[model samples]
Target chain A: MSAPVVDLPAYEQARRIRDGELTAVGLLQATLKRTEAVEGQQPSSRPYALDAADLEKVHAFINRTEARALQRAEAIDAALAAGEPTGPLAGVPLAVKDNFCVQGTATTAGSKILENFISPYAATAVERLEQAGAVVVGKVNLDEFTFGSSNESSAFLPPVGNPWNPAHVPGGSSGGSTAAVAAGEASLSLGSDTAGSIRQPAAFCGVVGMKPTYGRVSRYGLIAFASSLDCVGPVARNITDTALMMNVIAGPDRRDATAANLAVPDYLAQLDSDLEGMRIGLSPDYFWLKIFDPTTGVLEEQPISPEIEKAVLEAAELLAGRGATIVEDVPMPNTHMGIPVYFVISRVEAASNLHRYDGVKYGFRYGEDTGDLTELYRKSRGAGFGLQPKLRILMGMYVSAEQYEKGYYERALQARTLIRQDFERAFDPEGQYGLDCLLTATTPTTAFKIGAVYGDSVLMQYADMLTVAANHAGVPGISIPAGLDRGGLPIGIQLLGPDFSESRLLQIGRAYERATEDASWRSIRPIVVRNLP
Target chain B: MTKLSGLQSFMQGSGQKDPASKKTESCFDRRTASRYNDCPEGEEVLLPQYPSRQDDEITPEIFDHLVDLAAFHLEPEEREYLRKELNAQLKAIRELEALDVSPEVPITSHGVPFKAAISAPLREDVIEACPEADDIVAGAPETELRYIVVPDIPHEELE
Candidate 1:
């Protein structure tokens, strides 16, 4: 029999449907069945006891749009029959990170504050994807207000479990988006990366995720999450599929002023291109952690996991064999400061953005019996938001307070300048490094057990350390699964390139994918997908 | 009611089997030890700390002020936990102070500079009616006659 429809790469899925070998409806049915098999239950605001199955299955979705997906799938097939042009994606199954508004769908941002709000118009990214004939399978879960590095902060618990091994977290705040694709629930997903929301989770879940340069994709209908840092991109099972998704979503839109008003390139055009003569830099700074020593009140540097470091080095070796020159000891001194800088910049923006969620406008509201407007605002905001949002809002207020602005907000912005300059120097042809890209481990370690590092806000923020600098620099980064660690957990290697160079990043990732096509690790499926009937 | 450990028990009934070997107090408890337990065993780690800040955090009075300014009505326990976490996070944010950044360093408000060539020009100021205005107004928690309704304003006269 043809390889299980759900297990095929997205490009293959689209081609099969377009070639008349697979009907869009039939493919969507198979996808739904696979999703049902791996997805235990839709997470919710109502507390429910978790069971053995819930622990083992990937809880990737907050809302399943099966009926809507079926209708869209049938329409695509009907269009094909009538000789009408269907978009390039044809009938591929797709999931959207809930932060992105899908018209008529509840865009929760995984926060109870938005739990009841329904979007009247779709996000530009979602609109483009649907226009490309990708069926919207469902809206996936995420950290509340996209505020946490792990999905544990989502009010709708239990948060998304890593598909590779459900006991662990699927990194966040795009946890559900990556987990859904990894588990074969969807061929592809649209995810946003702000301080590594998409790339970090994609790494943990053993999927290919790209955060195109900021402004590469329009953020028109995406609920704001650190607006200056937020970026929408694709999560897929393979490099080619990621490129396919990027080809459709990466472009300018009038709705988003930040979007680059430039011609979009065909991401698929450069796949399989040689990395020959390309200079890829390796920075020692990416291989460790810098934290404050409580006693001295000074920063301390600690090295990363030897296994993860080995995976990145091995990826470099493999690329070297593919004709790429590896430059060593490239100093990204400011890399260690990404999370610290992000802590201030992101919260200030988050606090400002969330201010729009008052009781008077759309979204969750407090009791009608409130005595006055101020009381109504307090009750609604307190009742609607989960712990993470409250924490961010309070922190944002404290940092941006008149007395603290220069010490925190403006300083963080300047720190951001230094972070950006680090990339500029490394990528500058006139500079000593002159590197086209930098290769590093996507995260400090592989996926950690669910709840392992969730409660500690400080520890949780560090999860994005390796991936956030790219966000700070407005560069594109792709996380590709390199190999499995000793625990049989997937390890990801990241490739970060200069601004607006998503095509080059994808080309590099595609080279790695092609080089490791027959590698034993590539054959290993996620635990949730392994025994599915 | 003490603050949550960096590690937590599966109160959600995640059905995670108890480990053959459990550490003191909790399965993955390392608050006092370090917060990097997620790293491979024996991986040297240094978790962020701020002894002075922890001892003399601005959280007590400032935190309450912040909570009110943010307009949240947090429960006492929740407030305590949030306050502690916020203090811990602030300690971490304090790391930015180490950079010898000067006023001359141009602040990067957005990562990629929005050059005039690549940046979209401002949209013309036009009164384009939102086709979904009614839909949006109707989405409010409480609305009447296309206006979002709320409790009494409780205004006071200026001195």
Candidate 2:
């Protein structure tokens, strides 16, 4: 059966809208309605009466800007009626992760500290998307301060469940962004990755998430987590749509000094490029053997699950069959250092960035509860910040502290440099193992049950094990749905490219999508979409 | 002095000493008495139940110090949980120390730095009105005519 209008891919929806087959307003209304159906409202008269089962299926958004969305859609329609040239993404309904400020919307960042904070200005990336005529349906949820790998850390909202199975988590801290796209609530989403926030969740939710090379997309107005590693990128159902979304938001911005001054390329132009003559690297060391089990707190020399390994190997073989050379067992010696390096660096930056919410200005405040200024500072943060953020802050403070800086923080940074050099060695055309891109399982496993890793802080932290290397190396990474596990949960294969190799990454991802289309692998929609309320 | 000890001394020195009583009182609360049992005139006054850490392990005392350093007012249970979490993180971070990274490898504190050849255009330093100035203060819990009002500092603490 054909999918519902709301469930169509973003590019298809945009195409239909442009061809007069669909109106931007109709698409927005359908998307908003689907969103409301999935994220059912709590009964205001008796908020406590909401059923646990109902709450489990709900909560992909922190706040919905329906009025603004409809207004934007109407404007798009009016412009189309006037025969004015609309931008590439005209009439597409998208979701912005709450961390990205959207003017006139409550951008809580899934934290109580910013629960009531309305952004006075929108993020530059969001502005670019809106200017391209994409109607933002709402601000989606995320881990509070974007700290946790699971959505459980969000203090102000319900946990975002996986669309594949409501009982499972939609990997995080961009869980809601991925879940929204997977559940057909939003055609596309903008998610930030500071150590795999975008890719991990996309892997879990069976959607495409791209973390562009660091500074490739402007980080202006994006709530800073780890300034050096953070990137704003797109999450959608397919690579073409992701490429299209990237085209609009990838340019440099003067507002963000870190944004690369390099010219943005036309991503869609190379979407159909074949994998012929390309060399794809497969690292047996990291991807297959030496999996770290956070639950047991042990790093073992066992292979990954059969299904995940098969899917990754098949992806490599598929490319090989298409004339690309599959370079096997390219040793990434320092691959094990990704988690530790990311942990130290991210925590340090998170501690620094989160200091802005001291209750002295726009966010939550506790001055009224205390007569002392220091007490106000402490209490406001104590009451407003969640446990996960507090943990990260403490870790950050501890590492960056005088005693531990050399052994932990500085060493981690140096270790990060080594990790980047590892990738550089693999990507160097003149080196022994020159590669176009490296392929691996986006996550070690498919979406785990919700709360599975929530209680285990180590397990939660290790969820970014496979994806953090890209962020640490400041290269681009993309997660595309490869196949399904035994339980029918979607599995994703990741492709990591050298810095500014987004066009090549998209080209390979699109080629894989085409190769798998005949097997219905690329078309596997989450059960949530089929059973949308 | 070691940075941690230096910070500890700074924080210890900044404590509000009761001038008349010649005792160091609790810096966080005036209602509470001195945190130290035997008060010395000039020696460092440490909290009796300060969460202590050994080497890399983030002990309860060290965790508490970290909380204060980060200005996070965590509850007792939350503090305990974080104490454990921080220790685990520190343990995990030890993996990085195990790696054979040469001292010559420059630290990548920031992701790959911008190209040295490409000079970034500088914006002129000119004062301009903030369009969101009113909206910025709108979310404050308490506000005066046009400014966010924070709690008043204690006179003795200020001095």
Candidate 3:
């Protein structure tokens, strides 16, 4: 039908290869060819203007690990030829978010600071994926150190474009992770979600992305942004593949003391697509948007786009038809405070984590002779980090400063408590609403054109307000494509559940996916792939 | 930097150009500084001072102190843009002040209630010698025989 090799889902690809119907190497070839066809020139450090020819195509990868991928693919093909047992993901190509350390690839977190820095050890997620027989195709682009809501903040220029239409942004800092999957360059991706990094981009790129419960996945090798808010998760073309990815990546690791010790659930096994008795919530707090008026320095109340609200309402109807109980007007009063709390909490943690990037380490350092260590530190960081990371460091220092900690830092943490409490109350089983999950629109609006809201950090952060609550509450949320808007841009709906509820989220997501499979928009392909032979 | 009359008590030693200087030209190149979004060196911006009850909206003086403490030598344009955004975000973060959180609300470092029961058990602290010492050192920007090299650490004589 649509190119037998690359068009199939991750599980299908693995099955085809594992069953000897397709060679792993042959599938790898098709994947590489598709990547070459769709992915334009790899993005470069900002201020280094891209060629005009490079602007229209999807710039998904920051660096491709073709050599290593070929080796893994060949090994799998050999393992299959010898009649040996193969892993469930025997031939699935994986695009890792640049923040995750992959041994052979230069894992720049879409920043120039780590342009040449290669990790000697891979992240536990990457390690587990490879052990489960997934091939690492390359490192994808992201917001530098996962700082911004859009990929535009990446020091690497020509920010990751939405696969649906490259002129638009593929919401970020895991923009490239979702873009690759949507463009069919990779069947699966490992994207870290800190404050909606994975879910927002996946929603923008029209792919399935999930943020597992905090500590559900090991953060041992992820380049830290806001550690408490960050969750390493999966990005894929379908719910099943997302589940397949979660099965491998979601587990405890001794290296990360914060990793949950509970047994990892087989996410694939839980995707029964049965929504019977599930209580899905609808909060009025989420339907409204808090628009930050830069001119007035105040957050103004506004309704989200009519199209997005309709999508959420329609999704509630569809799930209701599938036997899920719909709970409306759930009062999540503190939901509106997600971004405000995130600003203080994420910044302080970002500031603390970024302290390790001194010049003497593996990453970029000032090249010139320095008079002292302080001078070295200033010049290296000033030169190495982009505006956003520097901005974060400055904010972190200011808020956490001795004089300001009580008012800003500690106060934000307490506010975060209220946001968490909102979820706790809703999911408390014995509480009033007792929502098994909250169903809402993934983003306030559909993917916007590149450069639309990049410079205004406050405006950009608001794009994540609908999704940031899950990050704040350390709950798991999944974003799945609902339908296309009048602009032909994809609309995404999200489902958020309490701790260790990834399986149920995936199950609900799979049910929605099955329901939408026969829709007319489902037949549409990304413009980048529509004309390709 | 114009020294705030009361700021010298805690904020000092930020090598700022005097605000009263008759020289109109900035130490930073105007043309290059203007390329960034806002806040060229000499251009002054003032906003309402509001720690609400405590007079702590980030002023130029406080911004300078934060820049120095963060060990960042920002371009004049960057300084302007960052300071503007920082204050703007601080305004948004003021949403926290309106919250009715009392002193008794325990803070959560993470969303999941990470009781020790669910946390990874600590592994035995056995000294397994690292075999990749050479490999780890190879990543340093400057290195000497098995040691990471750096510029001299400067110190001043004690008074």
In terms of docking quality, model 3 is acceptable
Ranking by TM-score: 1, 3, 2
lDDT of candidates 1 onward, in order: 0.83, 0.78, 0.80
TM-score of each: 0.93, 0.89, 0.91
Off by over 4 Å in 2: A41-51, A55-58, A289-299, B1-56, B117-119, B155-159
- Write one digit per residue (lDDT tens) for candidate 3, span A46-104: 46443455547888888888988999999999998998877889989999999999875
Q: What DockQ does each prediction reach against the true complex?
A: 0.37, 0.20, 0.26
Residues B1-159 of candidate 1 have per-residue lDDT tens digits of: 111222122211122223322221121223322222433455433332323444656647888788888988787767766877787787777788778988999999999998999999888899898998878887988788887778889899999
Q: Which 10-residue window in model 1 chain A sums to the lowest lDDT?
A: A46-55
Docking class of 1: acceptable
Residue A24 lDDT in model 1? 98
lDDT of 3 at A93: 94
| Models ranked on DockQ | 1, 3, 2
Cα RMSD, model 2 = 11.3
Arrange candidates by lDDT, highest first: which order? 1, 3, 2
lDDT winner between 1 and 3, please give it: 1
Q: Which candidate should be chosen as best, given lDDT against the real structure?
A: 1
Which parts of model 3 have CA positions greater than 4 angstroms off?
Answer: A50-52, A291-299, B1-56
